[model samples]
Target: MTTQTPPVLALDVGGTKLAAGILTADDMLQQRAEVPTLAQEGSAEAILGRLIGLARDVIAAAPERPRAVGVASAGQIDPRQGDVVFATDNLPGWTGLALGRRLAEALDLPVFVENDVNAFALAEAQLGAGRGYHHQVLLAVGTGVGGGIVVDGKLYSGSMGRGGEIGHVCIVPGGRPCTCGQIGCLESYAGMRVMLPASGYPSLRALADDYLAGKSIPAVDEAAHWLGHGLAQAAHVLGPEVLLVGGSIGLLGERFLADVRLSYAVAAIKSYRNIPIVPTQLGADSGLLGAGVYARQRSGD
Candidate 1:
């Protein structure tokens, strides 16, 4: 008789979307489902219930029901305790939610939780852009800006679990206020939510299309400047072998990459100009795949 690897169920909670899937031990995701997260319309309990409902839907859709669950959430997470230690207003009522305990109890399965960006970096270290490099950085520019670092093959969560949070790095002094209670953060300038509106465009898709068509997009250029400056700072400090950009905004296609690289070339120190700044190979599935990786690793404990 042959024993097969069990499947892991993964969930990702964002301000705008909730996604779930069953991941095989081999890192393939199946039976994926996604839905909008209407944070303002519900209490913490109601939102949690909705998340669980989505999980159940994916579970039912999966070919093999999974017994272990992993969650990657957008907020400050206490991975050791499997709790959401704190969440800013970006995710209403997500703070202090004991996600691991709550889900473990509700579904009668082993659960693990991680900061979403950290999870993304973990997956990158395992099989994505950071595959061979021991020092890597991941920057995600989207609805919210997020970042993660891999040092010596491990996720670097500094004190307060905010290590490698490049989004909050102040790029402009006395600049716009950041959600993290700071001013002039990289996110303030480079985040899609901010850049899109500042672009005066209907949407990022439109802005990206125009940019790809070789049209002059002043707002996009400005945002690229901010992004490059931030990456320059990270390169100066971390000396990462590669800097990978991901998330909705980062994947705006090759033009975005080229623009950021051009800016980075000028802003970065001459010695560091050779570093490759590329888009994440894992794309949208990184968080889900990473969640599954964490779930399988922790379930046996």
Candidate 2:
């Protein structure tokens, strides 16, 4: 008989896509799958049904049935209570959802729910860019500029999972509209959805190529300016030893980090400029991997 625990099922839900995988006790991803979120789909229940079905398919792909499940969702999730307090239009009708209990009942196994960005931070802190650092901060600039904070090598979600929401920080102060119904948030200024088009670039890769070739794109530079300011502000409060940038627009935080550093030097206090900002090692799969590890740990397995 094998003493090793059965693999855990990990699900990562984002505005653009949904991904699922089976993670072994050793942190190996055994089976994985993906699908478009198509958030236009009328209701949260309807979308969740699709994800549940997709999760089932991936779970079966593995040799053994997973004993637990962990979900990383893009919203204001209360991990301690296993519910969603609020969500942006990114995931319509996601507010006040009892995702943890619902999934536990449906899957017949223990379930853990986490904010997607927090999950990313946890994964990076353990296995990626933030490794070897006592404190780390992760800024995921995908559809929006989501952030996660790790303090003293541990995930830091404030009392109600509201600790590391760096995306909503008001950098522009009425400059751009945010999905959170706020004006001039970091998301408004740096989110790829708004920043990419504003800069006249079709994609982050295109922007990266142009910037790497020593060309100046208004949109990219503008984003860096805001991001640097945001980072500087975060540095004062969080005091992390290392900072990581990730998500689709990151492109290894290549040209972006350089520009950010330039701005950060001007905005942050003299001493705070010493913080090292780097690219995330786990680009797209941080949430998936983190969900698995988090579930296993929280479940006491």
Candidate 3:
């Protein structure tokens, strides 16, 4: 008789989209799917129902039943306790929700919940760009900027489970207001909400199209300057061995990268220099795969 190995179910709930996949013990995705998140629905139960339905669909498509589930959602997460302390504007009515217990009960298995960005970082650290490294930082610069830290090949959750809120770290104190109600956060400028217009295009994808058409936006370059400055500050604090740049905005052409690197260099203190900023290897599927891995690790399944 042959013993069958169980796959891990990975689910990622973002403000804009929902993605799920089945992951093998070797970190390979055996199946994947995605859907839009209609957050306007306005109720934790309703939204959770939608997410659960989508996850079930993905699970059904898997070649074999998964033994454990991992979920990645946008906003703050308390991984230690498995509670979603706050999901912010993306997921309304998510604060103080016992997400872990609810999902575990619903699925009849262990469920691990994590911040989407942090999960992205964890995936990259273990199976993607940061592989073989002991210390790394995963920075996803998209509609917002968030980071994940990996020390000694494990996630550094920090005190109070607020370790990776790099986007909230003040960069231009009292400059631009952020979604977190803070002023001059990195997300205010580097995030897609700001960079899209700054790139002189309607959106990040549009900017890519325009760049291909040889009509680059000067404002995009300016945004890159600010992004670089924020990254420099991050570099100063974490001193990570490698920085993986993920998210839709990172797809911006090398021109933007040049200015961002320049700004980072200029803003960085002398003590921290020469940190390599590279692109993500997992691409758009980072969050889903990360969720699977996180669940597998947390559940010991």
Candidate 4:
């Protein structure tokens, strides 16, 4: 008789929200719950308390006790130590937090942490749009832009676990200032923080609504163009088999993706222009699922 593997608990910590779920032995996410992060409060303890509460809420609904916990967070993470090496102001007071150790102590379970975008890429590569592809890249365009890379069916987090930071890629030399204290980065142009204001809309949903309703928003087009340029640069460097676009902005649907593709065609070399680019299949749950899967793997469960 074979013993069953226990489910894994997963949490995703973003600047805007905190989410928790259970990845069942059958590989489905269950007992999902989320709440606004309210990061502007600038209290790491408060945020962590909320995360722990959310995790417990989900665990109460799980069919079986989870074997471990996995966290996906928005920052440059030291996966070995489960520490946040750096974070933008979006997640104030997040840097230097010993997230993994704290969570392990709080939950009394083994805990693993990874950059949220890297976790998203892991899910996409193993179970979502990047499935069946050994080499792929994922760009998540939302309040900020982030990226993850998978090589030979494994996530390739670079030295210090900051490899797939595609958002910081320079698309324009000395252009707009970015939140990361850099100039001319792809995120400065394509991220929602810039695009929303440039579009003269109060919110990203409003801008997306107008664009999807056939209103030709120049700001949207411009952001897409820059995003394409960033992708072109990635193509030139990594030459991945597929490119996956996720995050709220990336979900603006086919029309926006067409615009990005057009700009990519203009920027990429002829030989690299034909690589397939697609949207992420896992949608909002990618980070949660990825975190769970990563924990399961790391824990040898």
Q: What are the Cα lDDT values of the candidates?
A: 0.85, 0.84, 0.80, 0.90
Better of 2 and 3 by lDDT: 2
lDDT of 2 by residue, 104-135 (tens): 87778889999988998888888788888989
- Number of the top TM-score candidate: 4
Model 1 pairs whose backbones collide: none
lDDT of 4 by residue, 1-301 (tens): 7777999999999889999999987888888899999998989889999999898888888879899998999889999879999987778888999999999988888999999999999999888999899999999998889999999877789888978889999899979998889899999999998988888999877777888899999989999999999999998999999999999986579999998999999999999989998999898889999998788878885
Best by lDDT: 4
TM-score of each: 0.88, 0.89, 0.89, 0.92
* Off by more than 4 A, model 2: 1-3, 172-177
| Of 1 and 3, the candidate ranking higher by lDDT | 1
Write one digit per residue (lDDT tens) for candidate 1, span 24-110: 866788989998888877567777888899998888888887979999898889887678888866678788888889998888888
Query: Could you tell which candidate, 3 or 4, scores higher by TM-score?
Result: 4
> Which sections of candidate 4 miss by over 4 Å?
1-3, 35-41
Over 4 Å off in model 1, which ranges? 1-4, 57-67, 299-301
Clashing residue pairs in candidate 4, if any? Answer: none
Query: What lDDT score goes with residue 281 in model 1?
Result: 79
